[model samples]
Target chain A: MHRLALSAVLVLAALSAAADPLPSWKDGPAKQAITGFVTDVTKAGGKDFVPPAQRIAVFDNDGTLWIEQPMYTQLAFVLDRLKVLAPAHPEWTEQQPFKAALEGDLATLGAAGSEGLLQLVIATHSGMTSAEFETIALDWIGAARHPRFQQPYTQLIYQPMLELLEYLRGNGFKTFIVSGGGADFMRPWSETVYGIPPEQVIGSQIAQRFEVRDGVPVIVREPEVAFIDDQAGKPVGIQRHIGRRPILAFGNSDGDIQMLQWTTGAPGPSLGLILHHTDAEREYAYDRESHFGRLDKALALAPENGWVLVSMKDAWSHLFPPTQGSQPDE
Target chain B: MHRLALSAVLVLAALSAAADPLPSWKDGPAKQAITGFVTDVTKAGGKDFVPPAQRIAVFDNDGTLWIEQPMYTQLAFVLDRLKVLAPAHPEWTEQQPFKAALEGDLATLGAAGSEGLLQLVIATHSGMTSAEFETIALDWIGAARHPRFQQPYTQLIYQPMLELLEYLRGNGFKTFIVSGGGADFMRPWSETVYGIPPEQVIGSQIAQRFEVRDGVPVIVREPEVAFIDDQAGKPVGIQRHIGRRPILAFGNSDGDIQMLQWTTGAPGPSLGLILHHTDAEREYAYDRESHFGRLDKALALAPENGWVLVSMKDAWSHLFPPTQGSQPDE
Candidate 1:
């Protein structure tokens, strides 16, 4: 009976050890920093103890939570939408950006620049009812697959980040996604994927108007860009939507520098984390000179700002979540 | 002993009956409508049942939740600020709106129209960091008393409406204040006064820019109108902030017509209520012909739209909460 009790105690110890909040994160300085910050802030009667209502945590989407590799997921969706909508507007066949997009000519499309991209985005994203736009986005997101991963785009979300979001939420912190991505584009799937409700997701927005047609009230998406939630816009967007400065912020690019500064610079205990894409084997690794999600200024200033640099190659034991019907990565 | 047991049973029955969710609401059709709608939507497995996540309730602030007679609380605040700021700007004594404002000339200020009001608002509300502005607003709101009521403006809030907010929250509905007032102005006190957080309050906003001044990050308010949250702007603001149509909406003026239409027009169980100020003896009673909070079009369309008209005099047993040192009104 004594021997049996000893074995049961051993098994219980093993189970308890396996219950680490962030199992996908390797034992490193990055992980230790995050755990330490959370502990300090949450300890009752401690110097850093923040009330639950003030425990606001902000996260950047795209490269921070998911994959933003050769191209952004939203950009991919826009390109696909352009092709699908080209036949409806025959003039698209002759238009420069449209023709370049149809031919999959990256060079010409790049040459068309931001104005051209804006035209493409507006054409695909607006001039429809908000509900209709949401349906179209949902349908595309459901069916679309990553070019290299051969998995659904949503499946490419980083496992460690997902675990971190859940962990923060478990500790009474209100997690908000303050992204440069379009708010409407992200809201449809954010709740199901990130466990964040639409109201908590702050992002770029296009002008929308309320109208009644056939006695049915509908919000119609217009072509004008109302706000951009990027760079300096990030802090402005956070202030506008949240009205309170977040105590913790996470991001992966220079576009997030302002947000991180705004968060960590606040008085009291705070933390800023930058995800360093240094894993070339598991995920494409490019920064500074990269076309997408370039991490430059933030990286140089990370140490001075007391921002934690989470090296993907060293800190993350696993990249993507386990795929169904497939063996788990060991 | 049997008589004593009967008395105890009767006392328990009285206690249970007194535990009505909306105690300040009188026994009337309006009260019944609100309770009935909440019951139907929250019933599990019922035909009219809605998921808790989609149970959104929106309320208008001015007149609907508090007194807006004599003048809007915000307008009064602006006038008071102008008088205090007169010494800082000697040019204001010469400027048209400023001169009229400093001299307490309501007719000239009114004749100056929205342009003059905009100038007054910008001068008083902008050119300061968000934190500074918040402190200023809080100080004013804490000290400002209603001209007629002689009570703090926050104390003039409708007691029955507060009970309704609590009741809806108890039934798993998330309550949001969609007001025409400035978001920053309301955010400083909304949580303490109305039990609504800053993030859940949507309203008019001015342009703001994020700046790092002397190694400290700040958001500076600019003298530009970014978006207006009144009239047609109501539904637009609701969609921008909440990203979901509210199932229940309450308002007191024509400015809320679109919001009411958007909520009840949805293909589900919904309720729209208009608070009719008919208590001239207790509170100011003006609607259709009133200069402020004119409830003309919405009042006429309320019957056909299936909106319940709640009479302040008949449907509310109490208007304001009990004061600390005053006897409770019967």
Candidate 2:
């Protein structure tokens, strides 16, 4: 009888061990915050809780899930392609945008602004079949290095957020990315990067055409764009693609304001968090005036909307690659 | 001993019944075709096969799965709304497109022609919150009837296709709709109509803005339109949304030619089936020259593409509302 009792205790312990919820998140307020939400939703006696089936947690791609600085990762690919195609198109030599792009001077490129940016993006993104674009994005992301960090562009993603995505998914949350990047560009590598499938990634879109070239069927990009997933476009992307307003939304820029607004405005339980770029030494810190990832409107709206603003400076133990280790306090 | 042997035979029969692949499909060519495909994929010796995970099936929503004749069900909806709102909007009587719409005159209403149709669709579709639009669609679908069919618009759907959708889903097929309709308009009702969730419904779209109106957030429609998912757009829709070429493609018109071509052109194994409208007595049969839902190019391409051109006159014993008690002969 005693032996049987021991066996029963062992079985109970084994089952408990097998069901450990989040093993990666360190024990703290951050972890508690997650567990608190999950426990309330999933626990038998918790009020203001959600059921398991409705456990939909959404993430922002660019800065929230991974890195989007030094311009969106796709734009980097476009810049590289601009270099490759510069010689073929001599018109680029005299053209204002292309000339600035070819000079490798980002300041001048910034001076040329959205018109230049649009011209560059359209030129690089168009003319390729969807399949071909996937190959190009994959190849560039695999080989391209950040100009400063010298690491592969993909390796610069936030480690804690990555852990958060997996932990949430492990808890039956359907993780999705509602980003302001091009949907096609993100869909190609989203699964590999964040473990979120292509279907769950929502973003901007360019119009494409279906044509048969030499008996081969291909979907080629048109010069026309369908939508730009920025600012107001973010909410539209979430509406058109995801249908469900996210139970949780994470963003680092003003562009993500509408997304947060939409997600939080839903009647039932929801979470809206902003990733504030506050770590000066570890990462760049500029708000309101920063051109690339402007966070002014989101900052102003955060308090009014009661959004949790994560001081990237304080919230994370590490920045990226995990192997590189955190930047020194200096 | 003889009684025991008979019981064993009965038990074997029961086991086979329990494990039967699909019981919904009738015992005919359609059934045979589906069974053969599954068998080839799962059988030990078949080379052209899919491992259950990669089995993605896409359907065109408008005509293939549901009725899209006389006018798209959504158009019928906007027209009904136009009539309802005509009284409120006094300006509608004097406006070019609005005046035409109020009079029930297609030619005059769309004096803008294609652009007029687009403007009407956009005007009616936007200006409301996502929830407002959803509720509107749900309410409209619940009560509205097709003008000529004298039945609820949703009731005009092809029952066999409905069964096929459920049947495929039961067998692990992830179904998607690559259509030419507005994505948001179809999505609000697709789940209720076809058991297809919004994310899986890809279609044409217009740009929308995320805004805070009177302290409440809403997605407002922009005047700018996006991709128009028709003809060549079908294949593009499949690529942009599904990311995988559907193994099985279905359509009734030449607008779907590029889709069939793209789906069939994918190497390895695929099936492209076209529904030929030939039963005028039961349902409308005019095709090839019809202003909308034309089937000429696809019909011509079927033979060389190894597609199955199904005759509505032959394949279906019943065309719609499976329980309506209307048999083909009757």
Candidate 3:
């Protein structure tokens, strides 16, 4: 009896020694809920559990993986691209979205809304082969700094979420980023930032044409929208690309509601988590009526679906790139 | 001395137990070549070897996994679709390729060439949603039987390759199908046929538009050519879908030449294999010049690229589905 008790104590110690990804996350109902589900599904003889074969977890990129505060990181990349390319294309002084971007008027640009966003994306995205776009994205992201943070846009990735990704993967989950951002745009940088390879990143895509341009058959960008991976489109992207409904889906806003709903609806050990922007001091906080990353429907869904609501105010110790003196003060 | 000999034998048994994917592949210089490389990489001490995370193995679907002799099973499915949908769209009688298909003169139908093929494909493939295409594929594949061979289209898959898929996966390689078939067509059934899920299958695709059709934003198919997962297009597909160069590539024809070359050139422990047709009685044997799956340039690249040439005749005791009986003779 003593020997059995000793073995049980040792096993508990071993479990305790396992690393938790989000160390700064407060041990509240949200944190408990996250760990509890992970433990139950991973533990042997647990009811709502899945084996390693089905250990695939998908995440939304924009708000979930990184800070999409003032603007989307990719769009910011494109706007910076327009500024760089604006010198060469002297005719763009009169173009619609490009013109607005060049002028740098926030209110006028905001009024243009999705149309302006789409136009900017298409203008910056098309007329090049996929290879060229990859090069362009790399060049812009490497050199350009976020307007508010004044750090490299890549540096603005969320700290707690990064740990969460590593955390899930450490516990036998194959984590993926399913975003509404352009697929190629995310593919080049995702591996470096999130450790999710290009294959594991599913995103919005425009139509590409295959033609022998200059003796090399290349996949060239087209202005047409191929698939929009936002809102209701999230489920379609997940269905089309990942195929399997993910065990865990995380996002911060109304844009991610469908993905959370789809994931929670899947009959298995699952989690639908929404990050509530309740902290304005350490990090930006806006929801419901907020223009970007609004957390309304998801906040409502939490109680009914048994979804975990991560309060950025309460849960995290710090926010917005925790690299001590690296990121500029907002 | 007796104990030493027993230990040595046990070590040899353990080594053989580890290398099982290509066990039936003939123990020639080719086989030794494969086993040696696999052993060097998988064993703890080998330099420039990939761990489990980097074990990405991609395969060509049509002739590599299943018989594409009579016609591309997908083409046959399309032809069947042409027949089924003909009565509904009599205007197709006025169409170029559909007119050719309706007449049943394959020589003339094929004579119209790529233009004719594209016209037929577009007319049949487009306008409907992706979900509709999947249902159409499922219905046709479940009921349609291949002529001459007289078996269900799914039953025409090679048993050896199926075993190989399972084996490689068991040893930590993520297998993907990079084929020129329509993505929707193959994705619907690939999971059932090859134990490969839809996400792992990359293929020729048409452009789609995201729009609110009847109050619901549906991804409707367009007649534009997206990326063709064939010939030189194969490498591009690999680059676009799979960000990393594949460690291993398998295909049966010259269409897979660039893919094989790309895989072989990957700077690590890599394998490139071509499935050569040599079995005359059980299956057709043509390589240098065949209508569909010709393997001339790729055959030439085997030695230069260090790719293994797998002769279907000698590699396996069985071809086709297991449920159809393994007997080679009537």
Instruction: Note the residue pairs that clash in candidate 2.
Output: A41-A50, B110-B113
Q: DockQ numbers for every candidate?
A: 0.77, 0.53, 0.23
Global Cα RMSD, each model:
5.4, 7.5, 7.8
Q: Per-residue lDDT of B63-147 in model 3, one digit per residue for the tens?
A: 8888887778888877878898899998978876788788777998889997788877887788887667767878888898878
Q: lDDT (0-100) at residue A159 of candidate 3?
A: 71
In candidate 1, the residue pairs with backbone N, CA or C atoms under 3 Å apart (3 or more residues apart, or in different chains) clash, namely none
* lDDT by residue (tens digit), candidate 2, B1-330: 254554454345336534543332345675567657656655556797675545777787777887777777778888877786677789888887878877888777645778788878877877666677778878888898766567776787886677667766776777888888878777877877788877788888777677788878887666667667778888877776666677878888887888888888987777777777777777778678775577887777888888777676766644565334343444
Candidate 3 residue B75 C-alpha distance from true site, Å: 3.5
Rank list by DockQ: 1, 2, 3
* Candidate 1: segments with Cα more than 4 A from true spot: A1-18, A323-329, B1-18, B324-329
The global C-alpha lDDT for each of the candidates, from Candidate 1 onward, is: 0.89, 0.73, 0.75
Model 1's alpha-carbon lDDT is: 0.89
Docking class of 1: medium
Candidate 2 is scored at a TM of 0.84
lDDT of 3: 0.75
What is the CAPRI rating of model 3's predicted complex?
Answer: acceptable
Instruction: Give the fraction of true interface contacts kept by model 1.
Output: 0.80
lDDT per residue (tens digit) for residues A121-145 in model 2? 8888888888888887788788898
